[model samples]
Target: MSLNVLITGGAGYVGSHVVKTLEKSGYFTVVYDNLSTGRADWIPDAELVVGDIGDQAALSRVFKRYSFDAVIHLAARVSAPESIKKPLRYYADNLCGSIALLKQSRKHQIPCFIHASSAAVYGNPGVAPVGENAPLLPINPYGASKMMAERAIMDISGSSDMRWTILRYFNVAGADVKTCVGQRPENPVHLIPKACRAAGLGQDISIFGDDYDTIDGSCVRDYIHVKDLAHIHLLALEYLAGKNPSIVLNCGLGRGSSVKEVLNTAQRVSGKNFTVNRKPRRPGDAPVLVADNALLKKTLNWTPRYQNVSEIIETSWICHQRLTGRRSKN
Candidate 1:
């Protein structure tokens, strides 16, 4: 028999991808989202519950209704610059809202949890190829919020019959192979999608900083294709159901991409050259952040397929045009 999974924020980018992946593997999913950032059009198959995670009453109703085998929590605010300006909102939405979900999980004895975390929690590790064992010193409120949520998950798992996997994602980019379901236009802060939008529109792309201590003097990030990232989440969910191991892993390609390199790749993939402008560095921007996925490979035996940048950009470009309704190019 297939297990039932509760996926919060299932109508969002990565959450929707996970829902599609899980359904292919024969898992029934129930999506709980308030539609704040998630779009209803994303989850075309699953049953969606329109409610907030902070609404404890709603969570209680859902928990009583469904026999959930796992809870994949993906609902949270995800922006560093915005978090810095509104730390309280980050805590309330990301951290406090997580606590409410954990309470429900514990109340209903949900067996597994796969949390969607971010590499921002590592915040300028001051080391290349940062490992899971590396110190977590988040410099921004968004990172701090993720860290606090992780802590809550751990605290609840230790005392309850719950197994958890926290997947700290690097720069997740690209879209699904088809133009059917990809990121929405309102996605504010992802690098590749924004770049794709610029390339598709024939607008200038902004490289935040050009003086970083990297090969191209631009900020470096470990870009993992969104499809690969979603698979890791599926693997984590399966591992938790079968083995029930508490694991924390970094999801990435164990390499770095400079901002300028990404822009050039975007232009090449789209067959369109957009202007590039370098401005002063954005505050709280890290010079370099790459992942060391040794633990991820050993623990989950996962391998990435989209190791090249052009392929990711190609898919992203298609999705960007689709997102913008194939607008007439300038």
Candidate 2:
């Protein structure tokens, strides 16, 4: 029998891609999501259970019904700026919900657990291309909640037979290479999706800050393509199945792109130009965050295919237009 995997928040952008990849790889997937930011259509082929991760009763029912060999936890609030405004919500969803999931996983005796962490945990690191060993000094409540979640996973796994893999992702952007699964434009919180939407509709794109201590005075990030990030999750699952020890990996391209640079790339790729509105730096904004992906390469023996910013933006632009009922410019 094929191994059954329980994917929390599997209908979201990254989770949907992972579900497709795993399904293609012959794994049976069951998606559990709250439908807050995820859509049911995103995972058409897999079984989807509409529920929140914090609801132990709901999780208990699913665990009893499905014999899950592993659990991939991805459900949580992900907006940094919004987290600052509503910190308690972030804590409740990201931190407490994660602990609840961990409890259920332990009770159910799930052997493998993969967590979706963020580079925000290493907020404003003193070094460029931050590594897995860097100190986690989160600047925002979102990051803090993710950090706490990581700690909880470690604490739980230390006392049990559950092996865990924590993937600390940088700015995950772009669409699937096949353009089937991409980010939705409704209330986009990320920069690339927002930029793609503005370019599609001929509107102004907002630049959060232009006075940061970096190239072009704008914050720098290491935007990894969503497909590439999804591929790594598959690799992590395979590694775990091999009875490998618990590990943490940073997911990125090992380089940085300024916000202005990405805006220019989006315009060029979409064949559209729009005005950039500069605003004061938002709180919880990091100055620069680039991942040191050397460890990931060595561990997973994997390389990202969509390394160019323009290529990534092109796929995103195409998917954005398709979803928004707009024609892509030639």
The model with the greatest lDDT is 2
Q: How far is 68's C-alpha from truth in model 2 (Å)?
A: 1.1
The C-alpha lDDT values of all candidates are: 0.87, 0.91
Best by TM-score: 2
Q: Write the per-residue lDDT of candidate 1 for residues 1-330, one digit (tens) a residue.
A: 378999998988888898998998899999999988777888889999999889999999999999999999999988888888889999998899999999999999998999999899998898989999888899899999999999999998888989999999998888896744747654546778878777766778788889988999999999998889889988888788886679899999999989998988888888888889888988777888999999998888899889877788888887777767744443
Per-candidate count of clashing residue pairs (backbone under 3 Å): 0, 0
- Model 2 C-alpha RMSD vs. true structure (Å) is 2.1
**Candidate 1 lDDT (Cα, whole model)?**
0.87
Give me the runs in candidate 1 sitting further than 4 Å from their true place.
186-188, 325-330
